[model samples]
Target: MVWKIYMHMTSMLCLGVAAFFFGGLSLVSMSTGKCSLIEWELSSLNSLTVVFVLIFDWISMLFLSFVLLISSSVLYYSGSYMKGDKNFNRFMYLVLLFVFSMGMVILSPNLISILLGWDGLGLVSYALVIFYQNEKSANAGMLTVLSNRVGDVAILLSIGLMMSLGSWNFIFYLQDMVDEKWLLVKFLVMVSAMTKSAQIPFSAWLPAAMAAPTPVSALVHSSTLVTAGVYLMIRFSSALEGSKIQSMLLIISCLTMFMAGLGANFEYDLKKIIALSTLSQLGVMLSILSLGYPDLSFMHLLSHALFKALLFMCAGVVIHSVKGYQDIRYMGCLVEFMPLTVAYMTLSNLSLCGFPFLAGFYSKDTILEVAFMSMINFMSLILYIMATGLTVMYTMRLIFYSLSGNCNLTTLSNIADEDKIMSDSMSLLGLGAVFMGSVLSWLLFPECYMICMSMFMKNMVLMISFLGALIGYMLNMLSVSSKLSSLLYYKEVVMFGSMWFMPFLSTKNISEAYLVWGATNEVLNDKGWFEHLGSQGLYYTFSKIFMILSSLQMNSIKVFMKTFVVMLVVILLFFS
Candidate 1:
């Protein structure tokens, strides 16, 4: 019956609408401070008390609005994109599940609720990633789920640690914890946030996540899942107000920014490049949030959602038109065939690159200025500079590769314009990217900027970063024999060598050798030690051991059965 109901369009639409209304009402009630209609108070649960205030923040309301809007857009777009697919009903169900889960995540008032939402989103995303049921998709889904689980465990630890410190409520605990204890909590939170946000070591999973459909990628990268990390940071920024955690966060953010930027430079896949660029921009926002400017972070988050969605959607259009080729290296001279798409893509990329007057410029400039003003340590300054430089490098590379590079005539011949639905969606998102900055001007700059200088002086560090990007772009375009071309081919090698190999080398030989042996044995031995441990089959061995020790219990069962049979026979004989 449930499956039958889900198969119908009307039913799916109703479910989506219901979820939207419920989420909206939750936000509205929180804003108005009314008793929630969906309330389920758990006074017995001490941890519930810690996160209660999370339900009522104005920022949460704003996040809910975006969640509903983007989710609705994806649903609308999917209706057409997925019209005749065999698994249309299944796809719709997953979409509904995704939206519902994100709604819960955004509206969750406590840690337990947040974890529930987080797990739900992660599960739905994994399912969606493997929707096609292909080998590559399945592998991608597994990687995504594993990485998310790692982050989820870290979050659980952070919550547990906070609770152990005698403060479970975020507001109370954050407000009441001693400086030292709070710092420790902040560290745990940062680790969790890093994994969720795909910073540095965890960043590789995001590119792999591009295995999902374009719409899923847009939803994940642009609006919801990735932003959860930033949301966490913003929600707890007050607690992290005056700690070294902020400085450490800034450094992590910068490293992610630099690595993603450099990685994107060598990427040829249009979608993968966009994914890396998303990571890079997210790093910028995290850095700003680290500087204790939630407003700036919020502004960038909004602008990034608009423009990055537009950019990804445009890439989707190109891929759809070309029958699934996403390599920008082979795609060229699309301006003639896809003039409107080119226009939209160009505008969105401009916003991404922080060109003047676009949404990105205002938000990014604000962050740069804040970082400059709030420099508490040398690490912060270095991080700020590196972040700025990387931002410029990758954003420009995305623009050049997609819109300006030399066209491969053969690839161009095979390509055509996308469907009207795809084009229209991209155009709409592009327009949003163009206009969102001016819509929220107050959040962009502090009043001090207006008073201190007659003209807004963009940070010199940012300027230098921009110059570095321009130079990199020029070098890429003008080099007759490409030095960077080889570097691009081996970019993954660099990333793996730096992020994985170096760390592996730093570990003690025993640990490193164990890892090496496990990798080899995992394939060589179908039932390897690590595999057995991973499966928790140690319990099975213990069960066998228990069976041997408790052989008397087995005899007891036989005796009891025999005694019951004898008693039944005696009763029968007496009756006879």
Candidate 2:
């Protein structure tokens, strides 16, 4: 245990140092407007070459810095979170593996190398998700891994497609890859990104993955695994510009944003709520990137990672204090007990809601304004507005249920912010949640984005956000005597609450049909027709024939001699 403690401290210290080094390099790269790419030729074949490539740009460097920073914090937090677990050391190793895989994806521009990291992420995340070794964890792990496998296959197909180009370094061929002939490559890449990021049909795994440990959630859902998709799209945004695929992605992301936000408002599970929020934010990043603003997308991705990680960590404290009770309905007035945890949670939540001057506000607000200013269709604009409001509404609902109101847990419950390790870990990301947005915005965008909107349009964001908050607070502030309206519209509420039954659609709905089909096939084919007409039937026929032969053999001696004598007499008569 002491050795494990020393290892944890050592890993955290190393990550912090690496973060600072990369952070400085990122700033220098930004100021100098230069990037370094180092390549090593591994082998060569006819019209094909395999090489390892490392890309060091401000974008990649800064993203790596944040990944390491958050990873270090999460690892420190996990020391306390998983201390009593038997596999604490194994957990640490898996977390480190997860981070290393993400680094590979971040630093490598080559598709083949990226796939190596990508597959590593999928495998390691499955291990992490099932760390608890329970049925729920096992099921969630299976779902998460299988959903990710689709993207893996997509990446594999894209690699096969890239072979025609003779080089896997997509960074150098963005322009050439954008032609109509290369549409399939672009489509494959988009699908791979979507699966990793959990967009639309792929969104079910994000929530299901909350069955993992909270620290893993903070790391996986925030900066590393989920964001890989958005980051991939960011790298490919140049090729996607002015293409039909980009427009299609715009619609898909917006729907994902709205769906996740609305579902979160109805969600009661604490970690799953945060997961849904992550989904919504991913939509914001991809949507903006789909609009031909990769830099803006990257900015949001970074800022969101900071606050979202903080939010998840804060949630870990709350859940840990309550003895792993995650239902928000039973949580209330937590601020009275866990003041520091609640404060940090509120900070992250408000940042998610786009409260002014915070880390989320800088990037999220910019994305909204840029969207309105873009030439998107009216329906897409409506989705943007609706999704934005839903984000605030769900955030407010979370705060109302968990931070204020009356405490519903037992009087004997011990809830306090006394865990120093947990508090210390959260403090780092709390600061990031508060200020990283403005810092990233300024650093990434030296020149200001021009905003030309009417007075009404300019105020629309604040107005919708205010309205959403008001409704969220008012609707949830029901007295004990008041009737629940959700009961009146139970079906509709369930449909909306269940992420439009996507989990069902992804799991039970699809599995149930296939299971029924399998059962039918088993009974009708394997057990019934195949048994009667196949091996079983043949066995019976062969047995009957053997039975006849055995019966004939019983009389065989006399009957055989008589038959032979008759045949010889006939032959003699014919000769005569």
Candidate 3:
């Protein structure tokens, strides 16, 4: 046990050091407005060359630094969270592999190199998701992997399509290939990004992936796997600007934001609620990216990562204290027992809601303001407001249910914020959640955005947030004896609460339909046409012919004797 703790400390120290190194480099690159690309020629044949490209732009460097930082913290937290588990070492190894894969994705600019990292992430995520080795984990792993496989295939197709250009370095060629001739490659890249980021039809897997351990949840949802898609999209934003695909992306991201926010509000599972919030924030990043603001999206991505990871850590602490129970309905007035954790949770949750000057506010508020200033359609603008409100609503509901309400757990429940290792890990992120927004705002935006909106339009963001908070708190403030109001709108609750039946659509419905189709296929082909035209038919036909020959041989003895006699007589006549 001592050795395991040492291992965790050693890994944390190494990663923390590396994070600082890259962070300084990122700052240098950003300030100098310079980037470095190193290429190693792996092979060259027939005018096609495979190059392993490492890009050291401020974007890659900054993202890499954040990923390493979060990874180091998660490892330290896991040392406490996964204590006494027999497979603790194995879990640590998987996490390291996951971090390595994310680093590959961050540093590679070549499509082929990126695919290698992309696929590594998918494979490692599957391994980590099913780490518990249970039926639910198994199922969730399957859904997660299969959902990501769609994106994997998209990346593979993009690689194939890029072959015509003789080089896989898309960054150098995206602008030149912006015509319809290369539109499909850009579209495929976007689709792959969507799946990784869990947008729309692909959103089911993100919630299902909550079957993973909480440490993995924090890492996956925050800096590593899911954000890979947004990062990839940011890299490709130049090609996507002003295209019809961007418009479509805008619509899909808005729907995803609204859907995830609504679903989070209705969610009971604490982990699932946070997972859906991640989905909603991913939509925020992608939507801004689609609006031709990749830098803003990238800024939101970074700020969101800090608070989201911190939020998941708090969730982990709570789940650990409650002996693995996750239903928020069974948790109340936790602040009484775990004040420090609740404090961190509140900070992260407020940041998630874009509360003033918090980490989320700097990026998220800027996105809203810039989006409002942009010339978008009526529907998009309405969804922007609605999704924003829903974000605050769900956050408030979570806070009220888990922090201020009457106690729901047993009177003797032992819950406290005494885990030093876990607390230390969360401390750094808590600081980030409080201050990373303003820091990133200053760094990412050299010149501030000029706002000329009317007082009403300017205050609309505050108004919606306040309204959402009021509704969320008021709706959940019910006595134990009171009838549930949600029961009155059963259908609406069911629809919205279940992510509009996305899990059903992605898993159960699709599996059932395929099973029925397989049965029909068996009856029509494997057991029907192939039965008559394939091996069975040939066997029966050949058997019948052999039976006829056997009967002829058995029944034709007289004819055989007559033929022999005739031949003998003819021979005798010829001799004479």
Candidate 4:
């Protein structure tokens, strides 16, 4: 009880801090023309320097506030979610560690310091992922940590390279790279960001990380861990301007958006659906950032964070009520029993679908409009359209499967919103998901978006959204067993649903080959030839030599005595 109260106090304290920053910093931002905060020197040397930085521009301040706000709510929710665990204090400590890591990442502009935060996040996330200590959690935790380690290495390398620039702080070079060859630093930073955001090849771990606790998922997956990458890219957007990497990022991010949307359509797990949705939104953030629109990307990031966090919290409520059955097929007709949860889910899901006047609408529509305005290739444009449609498609499919059907679970009949703590947390985030988009847009962009585009282009997204909804609903309700059998039984649909065989590639395939090689090496080298030839062979060889010497020594003593007598006699004769 004392620990829970302490958790509450700590969370409230964080919220209060965020509130002060949010209130006071807004005025500071308005009054001061410059967004850069006062820098505190951590260390200084001729060629290596480090500084503690707090970028108080709207982006950093607002993002940190949102992070702390969500964190506070997550901490509050965890009090109820983790009520009676044996390692409850340990859990809280891990959470605080995760938050501290995120805070460090948010405030520091130094590449080395950011790496400090970056590695901390990966480490704490691994601990949190494996907190349950089950087989699934263990496997997921390994994947999460190992995959994130790639990013850690990337940032570490970048920090080493930045030493050439005489400072570890990246803020000094945000306006431009030091020189042309320093593009390597930009590329390295981008790679680091991609790993954190779970883009393309790095995406397998995000969904797998769903094995973590609900609060971890709600906080890490939604607001902090994934957004770190997007925020990094946003910070480095100027250095990336006109570099070929942005074009590549554009293509990769678009495909990631499409892949996640397609995967979500086939997924039935409730938390996974939200997780994949988070991935899709991450792609959107990256795609916009790649177009050199960091401010717009920041807007989308903030909006996506609110809705996605609420979506996960709502998912947590459902999962908790349903007694850990996460399959959507077992979660039918929950709307009637759990109206508040359903409402929260609906609002967030609608926001995800770009429902007008909702939080997702403002940023999402802006991104699409900006994409349309940019002189992008036909392929990227097509991908953007289809990815948007897929977002709606999967969301509609999720709603139909989980919320609209008859009661499918046999264990519990009367489900309702009785958990005050969980509901209260969701309520706060729900309010954010509803209003955050407009608020962030107004605060970030004083001038409204003014883009010139054709009517077909303008209406195209809405039409695609409608078609996606139609397809999603039909796909869920349609009785096509033969079709599904062909799709599900075949390797192809399974592959698509398994995120194009990513988990297989990252886990079993990689582990199996290494395990086989390890076994072979152990048996053939360590045990067989090398073992015999090394220690045993040498010992046996020395023993045989020693045995022969012993035999010679024993036999030669008699001969030696006889020779000695002969020599003595000859010596006597010679003397006479």
Candidate 3 lDDT over residue span 266-299, tens digit each: 9999999999999999999999999999999999
Best-matching candidate per lDDT: 3
Model 3 deviation from the true structure expressed as Cα RMSD, one decimal place: 6.3
**How large an RMSD does model 1 have?**
8.2
Error of 2 at 462 (Å): 0.4
The lDDT values for all models are 0.70, 0.92, 0.92, 0.85
| Window of ten residues with lowest summed lDDT in model 1 | 448-457
TM-score of each model, paired residue for residue: 0.78, 0.89, 0.90, 0.87
Write candidate 2's Cα lDDT for 311-352 as tens digits.
Answer: 999998888877789999788999999999999999999999
Runs in model 4 deviating more than 4 A are 35-46, 479-489, 512-576
Would you give me the overall lDDT of model 3?
Answer: 0.92
lDDT of 2 at 482: 79
What tens-digit string does per-residue lDDT give for candidate 1 at 1-576?
344333443543554565466556645664576743233545545543433324645566666665655665565556556665778778878877887777676766456677777888789989999998899888778777877887788778877776665444464465564376567667777776777788866776788789998888887898888888888788778878778888778777887887777666666788888888888888988888887888788878877888887777777777766666788766666777788878888887778777788888888776776676664477666756765666566666666655667765463355555466566556556767888787656533435343132233444755676686887688667642365565564756565324443223333453568789887887766566655765557788888989866864676887778778999999999999
Ranking the candidates on lDDT from highest down gives: 3, 2, 4, 1
